[model samples]
Target chain A: MRAIAFKEWLKLRSWLGFMLAAHLVFAAWLYLSIRHQFRFEHAEMIYYQANHIGRIFYDDLRYIPLLTGALIGAAQFLPELLRGRLRLSLHLPMGLAPLVLAHLGIGLEALLVFLALDLAALAITIGSFFPAAFIGSALLTAAPWILAGIAAYFGVALTLLEPRRRYQAANLALSAGVVWLCHRSGQYQAYDLVLGGVAGLVLLLAPASLQAAHRFRNGEP
Target chain B: MTSRLLSWLCLAFLTVVLAAILLPAIYAMAFAPRVAPTHLFYSAVKQDFVYREHRGNHDFTYATASGEHFDRKAFEMSLPFIYYKNMELWGLLPIEIDGQSFDMQAIRDARQVFELKAREVADRHPSVPVHALLDSDPGKAGLSFPEDVFRMKPDRMEFLDVDENRVDPALTDRFTEALAAERFAFPARLVAGKQTILKPFDEGVFLVDAEGAVFHVKRVGDDPVIVRTPIPTDLGIRSIKVQENRQRIYLGLVLTVDNRLFLLQSDGYGLVELPSSGYDADRMDYKLLLNPVHPTAVFGDGGTVTAVALNEDLLPIAAYSRAVPGTTGMIHARISKLLFPVTLSLGTGNSGYLGWTVSGPAPLAFLGNLLAVGVVLLFGRRRRIAPQQMIPQLALAAIAGLYGVLAIALLPGPGPATGATGG
Candidate 1:
């Protein structure tokens, strides 16, 4: 588990750095905008400013986890399948379930590490201006994690089902469709429904894809 | 088999989706509170003349007597109590004339006297300041005097005739030109018995009687003056003229004489004695009533009076009064507080809801929660998934939902404390 976590950490380093950089720039922009626009005299005003900044950051940051999860899930799973890496791993001492579970474990670790670093950066930035409310800050810190999990679930299922050029194209088309539907619904709120539906679809599709892979590994035509 | 499994999975997803949507709706419907409207009344007083025409009674006599002086201290003592008891009833806008402060009450009293006396004077001297005669002098009579003139200012004087009408031209042009560039003085005669005096610092209009005592004249309207003579209590209006629709009520005995008129209108939420034009020969000793009739038929302590031409059933067909644009379609019904819910819907089709929407706050919070949950779930599935990975993502989604809940809690709820302010 520890080795798997470390490997996942190494894979996620670049993405985490990007997330940090983006959020830092966003936080700086928020600080400047708030300082310029509002007179921060009272504690209530400072709290309000912090809350506004948090909301803006959260709105933008929400998309990052979803995209990252999908990309990482596809990259890690599809290449292994196309190259028959899973078969080689299965031949080792590990059981099929353990090998699959290991991949899920690594993916989850990367997501959690990225979320923690990003949240810490946000807290430090906002804390300079407002005395942080522990509960509120903690709550805000947790939002990115939820987004990443939904993204990862969909990515895994998509990668497992079709590890080919056609599958890649289909995944891209489906993602675009999801984004289009969310935008046209006139309520970005439908993102949750889409994500949940996609997660369920992936879970349903995963077992079938793995069974086909298992048959191929056993040399059964 | 795969298709059946997929269908069951889809069904499970649909159930979750429905619960997510319905839960927020139920919470909002149960917890949200309502807001109400604020109510208030505003009033102002002015000096004007009231008069009645009697065709064959020409026996006019002039009597000299002292004018009743207003006691400011007495007025001040009664005022605080009036404000405490009837805070919503009276609106007071006080003015100063020669170091004497007069409230709305004084203005109402002054208006009653002026209207009654002006009518008598108009009847007696039908030819005085005759517009026909003045029209003959084109240069001298370019502008018609407003029906009611109340407050006098240095550069401007406010005149309130019957219809809240006003006449204000540059003093430098109108009066200075008429007075041959001389600083105009009060009690100055444009013609004898028909004088237009400039109050001190051009403060107000002070129309004087024959013996040189100042009688305040409050203008009512543009039409020929209409006054009601003392009919025996039993003798009601037999058949009021259709054309002469606007009317005022005057009461009280004459000052220093047998017949006086008091304007029966609210001033600062209470009754006031306004000045009026005196017509009897004993003008100095005479009292006058200058009750200014509101244009609207429905009257209350502080509500504005707008005149409407009603059918025999008292249903309004045509109304003549000042109203803001877009308010012309309003059906003015005297609805009880308890009946507001019923009557509120009756006129709403014609008049758009001039108030806020009740469900505006709920949808915003729900949307926030959805976005938060979607983003967290997406991010949580990224690399190698593990039990630990779910913890952070789940925590974040919960946090976002809490923030949305807090926003909804902060919004103001509904109730009966909202009212529109008058300009």
Candidate 2:
């Protein structure tokens, strides 16, 4: 399993590096834009815009994390699954579940590293000029975006892993439904309670992937 | 055995989930809820329903009991003073209403609205949250943002001047001493403050202390006005909402445990309880309109919208209430009534959270599940489908509804003679 995980890490390392650099660029852009606006205008005006007008400064970075997750999943899983390498790989020395989980785990860890760095960059740039209260709310607003990143990775994983075209389409549909739940919220921190359930949905995708592997091993047409 | 168990568990869960999703979608598409029209507005004072037909928004027409209709222009013209701005903009001002020429400025000055919504109310704590008292009497320049936000400790009060990044000992001590003079109990139960600087003028804030004693705290120039209101002992005040109104008649509003409404009058913090009930602070949304003539207070507990009109005396003039049906009524209700004996729902029509519960059924909501399972069983008749596989297939249809049906059709066993894990 360690060997397989290490193999997975080797495959994902390049994508991880790319995502990290791309996200840092985005963070720099967000910070620079805020600074340019605040340089000309009053700090009090920006504060008033948020407090009175209900404007969120970080609204532009909404889908960036989502794309990061989906792309990471695609880069890691799509090539392996589409080439039917996972079918050949499943016959290795260990139990099927651990091998699949370790494979998925490597991709998830890379995505987390990228997200943490993105948040730190946000705190440095936006945090420098804005008050503690406003910056805190902006971070909470970024939570859903990060959650979507995780969901997108798992959804794309399950969709690609299924053997039959019929099952693959159904799995993708179900995966999309779960991701849709994560994005339904309009406000920050509104999804705090239901996040546990969403985690369960993502984990359930693992078992579904194993089932697909079983069918693929049995040579199902 | 372990590997086989994993396979069955996976297949069962996936089957149940897909069945749950598809069954409901097909049933819902065929039989969805209907959009209800607005109902009667019964006027208790006049003993008749004021049948208002809203033609979109401002484009509405009103009719009397005898069916004398007033169009949008005629309606504004009739009220002359109520819709004074509309009349003036349309060159209908200066026309005397009821032989008395109404001053538009006077009417504007007298108009005041303080919306006290229960859902919008902040719950009181044993020890109050953060407090900020703005300089209510900022001289010359009028209302401006506070230099600092003040917080109360158990025995002492402190202020963090955000601009200076240090303690504002002078103003903090002045206000803290005033609270002591008024005998305000420390370790405050609920501390609320106005943070916004956009107002005609600041009206300061209302707070409750450790002993449930309510106090009016404000900054009058550099001096502090911290006085305890004469609220009756043992009165459960849930929250205090401060409103800065031009009328200056009332300092703020208080919503209590009884879902009762009260005005903290400007003079000596006198409390006036308005006639209202059934406003559960947790569930209902309330809106208050303050017009010089006919003010109205409307509150609803989602299922019903209750409106009470008030005269100038702040007493109830007329009341109107109506029942609003729930989502699964009419079409969804009719279909569910005719089809299945039970329907399974995840969250709700409004929310997308994953909460599992069973609702009133569309009896044959599982028809899709049954059909798919039947076809699978038919093909496998010669292969002899095991009770383990066959029973779950049946249960998915019975329990999951349409989504179960779709799952069975989509997720099949590996093949005949191939045990497919648990089997």
Candidate 3:
């Protein structure tokens, strides 16, 4: 398990770093834009516009997390599945379920770590110039974006392992449903409790992939 | 087989939620009857409820409750207080009201309006309860966002400067001291401020302290002035919205714990609770139109409009709740109830958010569903399909109604997948 975890980490480390750097640079850009509005222009003006008018400055990073999630998930699973290397992974000193979980678990860890750092950057850059409540709302708004990223991970993984195109389409469509569910609310904190449930439900995607893996192993297409 | 079944179960959960939200939306846009919105308002001068609604494309009809009809000019003249300038231009304005010459400027000056939307009330998230106050003193000619907003602690306050991104220790201490002198309990509950960039002048923020005491905090040029404003302790100030008006009669609006609305008196901290009969947090829409004669408030479920007339004292003189004709498509609602087992909607009332609610087709939805099943069954009987295969179809048709029947009809499920599964 340790060897597999380390091996998976090594494979994902550079991609993880890239995701982090990209997100950090993006967060920096968002900060500079807001800072520009505050310094040269009246900071108070932007503050009121944000609270009253419901215009968000961080709209650029709306799908960045989703993009990164897809990339990381594809990188982790596609290379293994494309060469039928998952068959080899099935023989790795563990059961197929636990082994597959280990692979997904490591990939998800990288995604979560990068997301945490990204959220922290948002807090510092935007938080410095705003009150706690405004910052809290902004973060809550970002929750769906982050969830979309995670959903993308499982979605890409499942699509990679599915044998039939029909089943793969179903996988993608349903996964999109979950992501869309997270993003349904524009009101702040509207989905806070429900999103936690959604996050737990996304784990089911890992177990769900077992069916696809079973088919792929048996050449069931 | 188990793995496939499990996967389908999970997928089913997600698909149902999606269908619930989507199918209804699809049905509403495509099948629902078109409803022309009716704009209704009561005119005091006309002494009749006025309504103007579109009769057809690019056509409208204006009417009054007394069966009087009006053209655009007469319509404007009828609500003289609202369209006073237009009435004056057309010479339709009565020179005298109750035999006394009316002052147009005075009427305009007395007009005031404040609106509350359910979305606005639901959208607030806790910010770091820090506030920046501007000096309302005439010596300070312009209004600007404060350099720093202050947060109170026990025996202390901290001012975070936006530009510097650091706490202004000295200013914090000065304000803290002033607040202490006024006997303001530390750690405010509700701190309301007009955080707008450009304002006529600063009206400062209102603060409710830990002990439920209200205090007015302002930056008077170079000095800080904090005054304890008395408010009823039991009022349970849910929210404080500071509305800075030139009149300066009332400072802000307060939403209380008991769901009552009050005008925060600018003369003092006294609250003049509005005569709200059925105003609740769930109220989808609220509109306050301050005509010269009286203020009118309309609350609605996004379909029905309840209009309230307020007298000179801003007390409710009379209020009538009426559902606007064609605001909701009656035929569509009835038809939809029959087609769907339960339709998913984002929100019909207010606070627009995607939420799952059970909505079945109405009118004859159950009957509509039965008819659909009957058609499918009649076909199945002719095809000589096994009774077992038809059971799931009938079951879905019964449960999900029209949507389910349509799904089964359009895309028949691959009865059961065969082939190597967990082989």
Candidate 4:
């Protein structure tokens, strides 16, 4: 298990580093924009705009996490599939399930770490300008977006590893629908009621790649 | 075996979710209802309710409760106050009714509009937990934003200075003591205020305390004037809306848990209930139009609209209702129920939260299931799937209907019959 995880990391470390640096740059951009707003405008009026007018000051960060998830999934899996490395990996002494589990586990852990950095940036920036209450609301609002990042990671892997063309297209459609639902909300805390169901659905997608890997090993199209 | 089961469950869940998202959109695209805008008003001259059904731009149909029809010119003359500009242009001003005369100025001053839409109800969107209290008495200069905003806590109220981004301990203690002096309970449940300077004046904030008592709190030149109203502690108040107009006749509007609407008047903070029968605050849109002589309350859903007019004494004078043609009885609507058993939506008109609602499948959906199963059987025969593999495919189609059929078509078994995986 350690060797397999190390192999995955060796392939992903440089891409992961690039993603971390890019995420920090985005966070810094969000922080600077907020500071600039406060420097010019009356703080009270800006507060009223956010509270009453429903202006999302940090909307620039909304799609960054999604892009990070998709790129990292591609970096980790696209080369392996193109070089037929996944076929050799499946024939290792370890079983197919263990091999697939290692790849998903490592990729998911990395994606979560990146998402956490984005959330922390939001917390520190919002807390600097507003009260602690605003921090809580900001986190709740960003929860679904972060969840979408995770779903995108799994979706890329599932789409690439599937054996047939039609099933891949179907998986792509289903995954896009789920991601769109996660991004549908425009206001703060809009998904609070059904967030648990959304998390459950994302969890169900984790094991889906294993079925595709099983078919690939059987030489099925 | 566990991998296979998990995969099947994943496919089933994805299939249902996709159907819920796609089917509703298709159904709406194929068959969505069109509704015409209708406005109701009370004619003091006729002493009855009259309404205008707007068919399209520059096209209107006007009728009264007594079956009297009117053209565009007659309709404008009937509701004189509504079209007072036209009345003035046509030299029909200074109309007398009920032993009183009203000109354009008098009509403008007495007109008050209170509108509540279905989407504006409780929990529809998130609000900032803290509120800025505009100075009610700005003295000469005009109303300006306060330097600090206040938040409600369980035991007391806290004030935070926006510039400093910290609490103002002195102002917080002062306001908390004022509320405590008036016996205002801690941890306010609902707080309503218009945090804008665009209004004529600031009436401050109206809040419902934990004990269900309503209180008015405002800032007057660096001091807080808190008044605890005589509103019943058991009114089960749902929400309060504060709009500061020029008249100062009322404080704001109050909605109760039992769907009762009331006016929080300024005359000693009296609660005057409006006649709101056949109104559902959660689903229907509400509009209250107040003129010099009467107030008309209008409630409309998609299918039906009802209007009730009241005298100055707040007694119901007459009521009129109209039925709007909707798509519920249309052929496409009934067909959609048979095609898609359930739908999933991210947000609803009544709430900002995302939720899943599964409508019970109609009995006709069984026929859809049967047809889908037959199609799957034929497809499997063409693919030459073994009897063992075909059973689950048929069962999925029979149970999940079109969703399952689509899933089966998208994902078929391995190329011939591979016994098992070498891995």
Identify the leading candidate in terms of lDDT.
4
Tens digit per residue, CA lDDT, model 2, A52-150: 445666666777877888898899888787687777787887777777777778888888887787777777766676545555666666776777778
Q: Estimate, for each residue in B230-254, the C-alpha lDDT of model 4 and write its tens digit.
A: 9999999887778677888987778
Docking class of 2: incorrect
Please tell me which model should have the higher DockQ, number 2 or number 3: 3
lDDT of 1 at B136: 13
For residues B244-351, could you state the per-residue lDDT of candidate 2 as single tens digits? 777788867787777787877888777877767766666566666665455667666647767677766778877767655445445555655444445544542322
On residues B201-284, what C-alpha lDDT tens digit does candidate 1 reach at each position?
A: 111122222222322222222211112222222321111100101123322222212222222221221123222222232222
The residue-by-residue lDDT of candidate 4 on A145-195, one tens digit each, is 988888888888888887677778877777777778788877877787788
Higher lDDT: candidate 1 or 2?
2
lDDT of 1 at B245: 11
In angstroms, the error of model 4 at B246 is 1.2
Chain B TM-scores across candidates: 0.17, 0.72, 0.83, 0.86
What class would a CAPRI assessor give candidate 4's docking?
medium
What TM-score does candidate 1 get on C-alpha atoms?
A: 0.29
* TM-score for each predicted model, relative to the true structure: 0.29, 0.77, 0.84, 0.92
Ranking by TM-score: 4, 3, 2, 1
- The lDDT of each candidate is 0.33, 0.64, 0.68, 0.81
Best of the candidates, DockQ: 4
Ranking of all candidate structures by their DockQ, best first:
4, 3, 2, 1
Q: What's the CA error at residue B324 for candidate 1, in Å?
A: 32
